[model samples]
Target: MSTQSQPSQSVLTEEESWELLAGQKIGRLATSVAGEPEIFPVSFEVSGERIFLRTKPGTKLAEVTISPRVAFEADEIGDDAAWSVVVKGRAQVLEREEDLAEARGTGLVSYLEDGKTVWIRITPSDVSGRRLVPGDQR
Candidate 1:
């Protein structure tokens, strides 16, 4: 008889989660409006512990303003393993000159050609991540 090890899933530490987040340039922003949920794909930058992204005046911006609480997710997949990180926090629009200037320092640009004039910052209250290794299943 032969014995084989199974695949495993594990929760990532906060530091590991942040590291994964910092490495990714794109994430999904989750927001709720009028008891409904919406997700927007955004190009983002991670500085320290916060996430920043640029947006135009539209659904994403409007929904975030209407409900400041939001969740952001980023993930990566490899041939042998996969991981995902979720950040839950409040989203704030940067209106102050200093904040706008700091956000600009991040050099975050929109993937779309549309003008993205607004800067939004997400300050996370909870950040968690999970990693799955497929072992031989790969």
Candidate 2:
């Protein structure tokens, strides 16, 4: 028997998207400031379908404060397959001490040493993902 294969992409379900988010440690957060778009690499943690990240007072925080709407993306590539997920939502700054304390318990840390004390929570309202697989696996 002979089989023909073709490269294909599949859209991940909402549950699958959340699963990917749960396992991902780092993602690019895209925000806009002064009509210019910017993307920042952020280490994050997932809790109850929401993402938490730590940031210091800087351009990222400033932009987020100006406009809470943002897009976040993460991806994983394998030998012959890959998948990517994107989240679109609003970023809310955790100002309350209790909220910050709770976010701190999620094990989310920053690689920068500037002391990123600000915690931002991204609540995804539209989460989507796609997976690419070699046709041979089909």
Candidate 3:
């Protein structure tokens, strides 16, 4: 038996990336604090060209306030293959009433009892994705 070194991966278009984001609910948020990097599982909603998430006042919120730049990623795994999408953008804390109202209309529900109602919007500058396939597919 022989083993292949590289598996096949298909690059997803921008539209496809956005579509995947809209369809997926759970994603990982990449942020940094005091030079250390961290990734947290987040529930997000896609609205137009921005991604919105609700988080309480905590480290994740504080880190983004100082850095602003962040990355959000979501993926799907199958028995034989997997797909991943990433959105690189800046995080902004929404405080205006209008902004909060608009985000509330998106049907965002928080599973935490800590009242994670602070809205954070990530404006994507780059959206990309890839779908991996088994070596046999190549």
Candidate 4:
């Protein structure tokens, strides 16, 4: 299915959905490794047109450090309902300390777990979201 959300009464407006997604501090980032989609839950924030994530030295850091293209997602769910937003983008490490600080500041506390804090940023080429409600099941 297309990533973009189909318009409906149960669905939130694109702007509303994006705003919700962007405000959240965590999501699943999907990337390809050896032809398989690798997805991981991560803490992140929307900074301008880019989404910034912080990771320690690990697969997440290693994967994007090698390949820049990546996908990001953030969603919120409730009883019998949910909304999700997807972002197709290019990923990179935030090199500057100022940018890193600003990106980290976006969330309550730090976005990273206790460890060596490494910054990863994704510049989105496409943004999409969808919402599911009770009537959609019919």
lDDT per prediction? Answer: 0.93, 0.90, 0.88, 0.76
For all candidates, what are the clash counts? 0, 0, 0, 0
TM-score of each model, paired residue for residue: 0.93, 0.90, 0.89, 0.78
C-alpha RMSD for every candidate:
1.7, 2.5, 2.4, 6.0
At residue 71, candidate 1 shows an lDDT of 99
Please give, for residues 1-138, the per-residue lDDT of candidate 4 as tens digits.
555554343556657766887678778999887777789888776766677777888888888877778988888777767788888989988888887787777663455557857778788888877877644432
Question: Best candidate, lDDT-wise?
Answer: 1
C-alpha lDDT of residue 66 in model 2 = 96
Candidate 2 lDDT over 17-136, as tens digits, reads: 889888888899999977899999999988888889999889999999999999999999998889999999999999999888879888886666578888999998899999998778
Clashes of 3: 0
Superposed by TM-score, candidate 4 places the C-alpha of residue 119 at a distance from the truth, in angstroms, of 0.9
Candidate 1, residue 72: CA error in Å?
Answer: 0.2
Tell me which of candidates 1 and 2 scores higher on TM-score: 1
The residue-by-residue lDDT of candidate 3 on 1-138, one tens digit each, is 565556789999999888888888889999987789999888888998789999988889998899999999999988798989999999999999999987888787654547897899999989999999877632
Q: Could you give candidate 1's per-residue lDDT for residues 1-138 as a string of tens digits?
A: 435568799999999999999889989999999999999999999987999999999999999999999999999999889999999999999999999988999888677858888899999999999999986732
